[model samples]
Target: MTATSRSLSFALKSATVRSSSGHFLRELLANEHLPQDELQARQDHAARAIAEQAMQESPFYRRLYGERGIDPRILDDPRRWAELPILDRATVKAHSGEFATPEAVGRGVRTALTGGSTGEPLRTLHDARVPSLALAWRMYSWWGIQPYDDLARIGRWSFGRMDAVKNTIAWWPTRQLSLDAAVISEETMTEFHRAVTRVRPRLLEGYVGALLELADFLERRGLRIPGPTAVATTAAPLTAPVRARLEDAFEAPVHDEYRGSEFGWMAGECDRQDGLHIFSDVRRIEVVDADGRPAPPGEEGDLVITDLRNRVFPMLRYRNGDRGILRERSCPCGRSLPLMEPPQGRTIDVLHLPSGASLAHRLTALFSAHPESVRLFQIHQQADASLTIRVVPGPGERSRRHVEDAVEDLRTRIRHEVPVRIEYVESLPYTGGKTKYILSDLPAVVPQAPTPPPDTPSVRA
Candidate 1:
């Protein structure tokens, strides 16, 4: 009958009606905090189950493992997990259809697509619901926020029909606030900060760049909005200096999250500020050198991850070309889960306008939303503030009109009548196993300046 238990009971009851986590949502909070050995046992069990099911169900894995005479049971032993071949993007692309389990797709799943480093669209069959939602709640718990606590997010969101309806009908009951960062300026931040001060969300989450922009606005205006217990930043790197600035601006602790569209959340920084704790129960993360061997201790290397949760498209030893160091040291917070430095790849430079508006919005995130229209793309920013988007056209079947729409949308988002042009290219350079999304000759550091007066007409923000 304790308050904490009561809240947990209520949260579970709420999820019972809608959760599509395959019954795992019930154990999310409990399992995430288990003792080291017990958590490892659970991780091994889930990893083995996924591997076994994938080998038995997926045409791709069945064929690969059968041809090699490898048993999926090896994963059960933990130590033998590495005997399996590292699954590369090229192989997955070549056998995309075979990677999907037809049975799981029939049971209902969503298609997750990405314009991978090579400017080629790639797809993964994702479950209808991801456990990361509950995992995020667990992260908030670290800051004394409960699962049902009011939360707010400031990021680029789809304001489509579904989200619009949710923004109205489910807004209060869900106690969630969605502050769109589709366009950012002093005017928009003024309104957003006003709303935040009114609602006083317990947890505020946003892209690092957008949050920094909002923070700058707050600082320059000498305004302080209190009452958010903590701020969570993602989508881009949160370096030491940036984290310090956000903390000072918000007057609250700032936490960093490393996530992806294909895989929900891989790691989240705890309050201790030690390092990011890998959600090892749902992901098996590894660091390897260029040769794919384990990196020397303490050295930075490529981060390869295995999806222990995704059964529809089992990501066994998948590498997305991200580089980071997987630390062996334990966290001072006493969490037994392995710690990792924030990932180093996939983060690109934000385009800073002459007006000091930084387009922290990732072009890759925008392009991925129109997967059918963008096979691959790179944004080149000239010193004159003109932008040339070098595009490799995606399939025209589902995206013929979307291509132009996405470009126009991008132009509107950048505002300032910044000259945004498109150059049709057969291919763009995707070197180093990572896409260099924005090649900007602009200076790396742009000084903060006051936003334009409210009278200045602005686009969506």
Candidate 2:
């Protein structure tokens, strides 16, 4: 096609997509208040459809399920997602090619690479609209923000020239002013602050670390941005102290958003902000125990999820390596979708002691409690199993005292003496443009094994 003709064709196609997406957005808004039974029915229908598609079209699921004696016809029977084996990132990485299917929702599927936040990078596949829909439902539908509202974002922009332009084009329509999270300095932040204040967007959104850093910088300089209706933080754990500072500094209500790079947006906060409402319509989510069976409701465990909409590369039971709890009740926002405790941290962050293991947030509880004294901290479990905490002092003068107190408090709670060391620093050094709140110097990652189904069939290549 000629260049001008191609441009004209693209513009026409874009208009059609926008019109249909507007209708889909309205349909999603309508689905928000659906009764529990109706929501379950929708989820069931989607799950059955996705599951059948995977078993039939995706080579990975067909072989895996067949070898485990899971007949494709079994999807016709009423079943929970837990009945199928738990799928982890490690397994997906090993058999990635087997996962792909020709099916898709939008134009077609494309490759997606994760940030390797858990120290292992992942490559997955997704269609275009699934991600757009995820973000829209999370922010626009759930958070009660409008799609066309002016938004200011602080996030990592790609270093590549071409990738950077792609990012710009993707976000261009949102009327968002974005600042690169990688380049945060007094000069850059000042420029960003000036720009944001000038725009006065309705909502401010960014990674947890970037937002906190901006809040700290603004607080230090005594410069405040007067008017953001709301703040949304994601990409890392948003502790209470972090949320408070963002709200205080921005002068707005702060909400936490939960998502995975491998999977699209899974859950996020609504206007009520009590808990994250899992996007159950597109995601079949469960909190699974270490053995991969569903954890009892209200108990925290690893999250095993399946994307019901992404037939392009169906993730049947993907353990994206994050851990949290599923609330027994629905959100107070009147959505029938199930609620979940917001992600505390990735499973890799969970500290393994000789006696027992502690969740990442619990281990950081003391430091999080002393936010005035400790600006940032990382809990590292050495190969020898000794624990070392590296802390960056806050603007407050009581860093040593608060660190001592945290050590003492942790000792009491764990009730066991483990070799523990403290290292103080001016800042948490960045690795790949982000800071790690928890690290493991251990040799390797332990694989999680799921319970096997009965009546197995033979394996095939």
Candidates in order have lDDT scores of 0.73, 0.68
Scanning candidate 1 in windows of ten residues, the lowest lDDT window is 17-26
Q: Clashing pairs in model 1?
A: 119-375, 119-376
> lDDT by residue for model 2 over 263-318, one digit each (tens)?
76777887787788887877888888877877888898887888887878888878
Clashing pairs in 2: none
lDDT of 1 by residue, 238-313 (tens): 8767876777777788898887666878888888866898989888888888877877547898888888878778
- Tell how far residue 230 is off in model 1, in angstroms: 0.9
TM-score of 1: 0.85
Judge candidate 1 against the unseen true structure and give its global Cα lDDT, from 0 to 1: 0.73
| TM-scores, each model vs. reference | 0.85, 0.70
